[model samples]
Target chain A: MNCQDLQRLVHAYLDYELDLMTSLDLEAHLNECSACRARHAEMRALRDLEARQLRFHAAPAPLKARIARNMRAACGNDDARRWRAWRAATAVSVLALAALLAWVVLPRTLPGPHQVVAQSQEKMVYHIANSEDVATALRNVANLLEISPDARIVVVANNQGVDFLLRGARDRDGTPYEPAVSRLKVRGVDFRVCNNTLARRRIDSSQVIPEAKLVPSGIAEISRLQTREGYAYMKL
Target chain B: MMPHVDAAYNLAWWLVRNRADAEDAVQEAFLRAYKFFGSFRGDDGRAWLLAIVRNACYALRGQAPGAGVNEEFDEQVHLPGMVAEGSNGPFCRNPEDIAIQHADRELVNRAIEELPVVFREVLVMREIEELSYKEIARIVDVPLGTVMSRLARGRRLLHEAIVARMKKESPK
Candidate 1:
């Protein structure tokens, strides 16, 4: 609590940040030190002079308005609610335009279902509803195309194709297609059942082929694959 | 909150040294504080705002072509406040007293402004703003020891500048 110590502590003392004992000790040092006391007095005087001279007049009303305008210009408009609504409307319009173009161009882009069986190179995919002999129909198509028994074929069935890919609750003749289909999957020929058809026919997903992925809207999915993915589609 | 605002304005005024510029800086600091409020979790809020003000000032410096770019400054001559409307007696009592007060304030301001930006900022925050050593360190993004040392150096420089100006003004 000497001269140098008191000088250093002036800032801390003015701030009233020191604890009681430290404050008392500093006060004791100040009482005995005249030079330090004068230094402290000068510092306080300087601080007071600064505070008085540095008076801040509030920004004039016009200046505040100009600054607020400048801030908004620099940072972009802060109107979240208006921007959000505008964004939503723009998105909806874009989607609607896309759907309209797809509808207008779809028919011209695709070959007929019967033409698909004849012109396909590798194999043709057939999505059958409910037919009495879907397997026979598929075998005929495969033979006509001179496809081997092991050629890659995808059968997407609702009630009809589901039973063909899986079981029909009763086996077709003495031949059960599920075991043959499972063995075909092992050989890489894909078989899938339509979940949409299964739902319509009141059949559960488990009743279809276990390996089959349930396409939600089977007809739209079939068209999508043909138009979008270059897959040829055929009718049995 | 009021004290912190006062402290920040004092520091800003000392740095920019114009009421208009200081007011703009403080307003910008408040807006920035609101925008980045989420990021400040465990810090002295006042120090954090001052740090943001420091950055804002720098941003304004770069954006505006010549603001804060030049340390050398010339005081603007003031317009005569009152003049006799018609061909009357004198040019309204000379206005020398008012002019002197304005000149003294401007001299002090210019002295502060003449310091390098870093030295001026540290001095203003520590002395005029009355921030703690730790708060100054945080605001300036420097070490505590550095803040203490800089505060001492900055004060010395300011005192020297004021004394030199006073001596120049007085008769030799």
Candidate 2:
């Protein structure tokens, strides 16, 4: 092939998209051509520069935690349901019955919510998965407090949701959301985050915003709030 | 959630162009992928996961300025004035030249952010993610020729933008 033909095919060759015959033809042309060879060299160098220089942000801690925790919880539930179905299809052995009875009689996995102060009439648990979720939860909290200032509302942020409680966290436009968090805090709304998610994400305890408290697990906390605290649950 | 989280994150980051939105997009995509995991039939799990991410990114309300749910790739509108590959001048940042001067990723990132949405994605798939052209074509749902043209044009614009930024940062 000629220099002009080789020029168009250089990218294809570099990308390994060229067919065998075309690659051989380009190699033959490269042996005799100076300018085409120089272009080829430059393309390789640029590709190298790109590989070394480009930066990528990892799947940050909270999101990673959210996925892992949600997946595990979802899978655990699905597996239990599936196992029960399988067992029902077959004969229910005495050993299976004993195991089922043991689970039913055991104490709850999460700690019971304490009646720390005067109990409010309305109790609600807000689940926040993203910063925007936090926004929705906060708006709901403010609206709820407007109607019932003495209402007991708890916002539980876990997984990627902990980002809302991160210090100096910014919205998509780089606007800080800290003042809004402070406003919610002053109104007696409680904010709790999942420590398991935080630990797995490798975020230090200090990274958490001042207004939020850490819980052992998000899923467990949500369960505790719903079952033990008599709180209505809303996930944003 | 899959072995492809890194690849998935990279694709979303390139498309959404920010940490918070990209994280949201990836989280939503993984949930969708997990929900539809049984329906997956391809061996290219990374590409499949990325297709979900691309969809999730578009579904977000006000993702980036140009990203939309139904992204139509029209080559005729996008293929004008591609720089000649053999030409080497100010528009092209030669590796030898780039090495001599300091190069910051933020400048390169800004140049990428400014491209037409489709061109930016194609370039990102090919150059950053190192996906094959066929894989990119599958993910973007365009023909092979469209992929080639966009990639070439995207690379052309990216190189020009990088060189332009370098010149502005440290004038010769």
Candidate 3:
């Protein structure tokens, strides 16, 4: 093999990805050519140096422990539900009796209006165009939802959302709520702001929540969240 | 949570480099994930959590851009002394063994952090996490070829950094 051919195959050969015939040809060439052999050795040495240096620096143990803790705290309540289910399995007879009594004693409960609307899956993120301050847009949505200090609503706004935020009215608290539109961040409800929208609005990263990341486009991110991630967007 | 903890921690570790930062990022990611769990559609919970980790790292850095860029190394130094005081001794196996193990880890992490933000992300996903190129492309919102090219370049750069470091350490 010529020098160029040998060089081309060198990386693949090192990785053992070269086909048998090509591998043999390269091997033969290396045997005959001192320069290629030396070159190959250098590459091999470089690869070895990298492997040795490729340290698994354990992430700070405290951090690992913390993540594990939070994830547990995050997922802990879930296991409770499972335990409840298992208990229900063992006490099926008691549950049946309690259900019968409850059914006879209480009036049938109907779903609330907001609950119906919330479950509709008809939420569409309106692409508000060319305004400024998406965080303010989110704060506006929170206000529109009449988001109180303790009450949080999922708000996903991106580029156009910025306009919506800029135009958003103050809550009863009289505080201008800057909506923190994160693409997949939900403080308790999912909210996404478009990276594209932020760009269109000429807002830099500082204006938005660090949690609010730049997705490709606000509208597309919204659509994907709704269809792929199952978030329902509502225009307030 | 138990099952996913290791994976989540690993991903966070890769992204933030520093343990404290990684922990902070992961914890915040979990909180955000939990609050947003209702929004999760399919089962790929790991990826969803990782997406949150990515955001958290951004958030941490956003809090202090200057600090994040420095990639604090002193945090690792306090570990050995802390381990001695603590009951677990150390989850890092043993101290002498870690010296060798940590050598490579430090290099990998330093090299990774040195990479451009875009390339560092792809390398973390592809190499550390072993994600598919397509999946990485989707997460980073780049094209497949861009992902591949970035991965190749990232590896090459990582190799270059490692070799340089080794040369500096070796006796002349």
Whose lDDT is greatest here?
2
Candidate 2: residue A14 Cα off by (Å): 1.2
Candidate 2 per-residue C-alpha lDDT over B1-172 given as tens digits, one digit per residue, 9 for 90 to 100: 2234556777788887888888888889877876776666554556777888988887775554234423354423322233455565222333335441246767767778887777788877776566778988898887787677667656655765776778778876
Error of 1 at B20 (Å): 9.1
Q: Model 1, A1-236: lDDT tens per residue?
A: 76545645665565444667877887787787665565555555555544445433334556456544654454465643332222222221212232233334457555332223223233435567765656544443333222223334565666565676654444433456666556556655556667777777788677665756677776876676656754545554
iRMS of candidate 1, Å: 23.4
Error of 3 at A38 (Å): 8.4
Q: Can you write out model 2's per-residue Cα lDDT over A23-140, one digit (the tens) per residue?
A: 9999888888666676677666556566667665556767767776766566676554443233222111211232233234434562222121112355667788876576556655
What digit string (tens of lDDT, one per residue) describes model 3 on residues B1-172? Answer: 3223445566666666667777677677767766765555533444556667677777787743213322233123332222443543222222221212233656656766787665577665654444556666666565665565555445545555655565566635
Higher-TM-score candidate among 1 and 2?
2
For all predictions in the order shown, the interface RMSD in Å is 23.4, 13.9, 15.8
TM-score of each prediction: 0.41, 0.52, 0.40
Give the poorly placed runs of model 2, Cα more than 4 Å off: A1-7, A77-236, B61-102
lDDT of predicted model 2:
0.66
Q: How well is candidate 1 docked (DockQ)?
A: 0.03
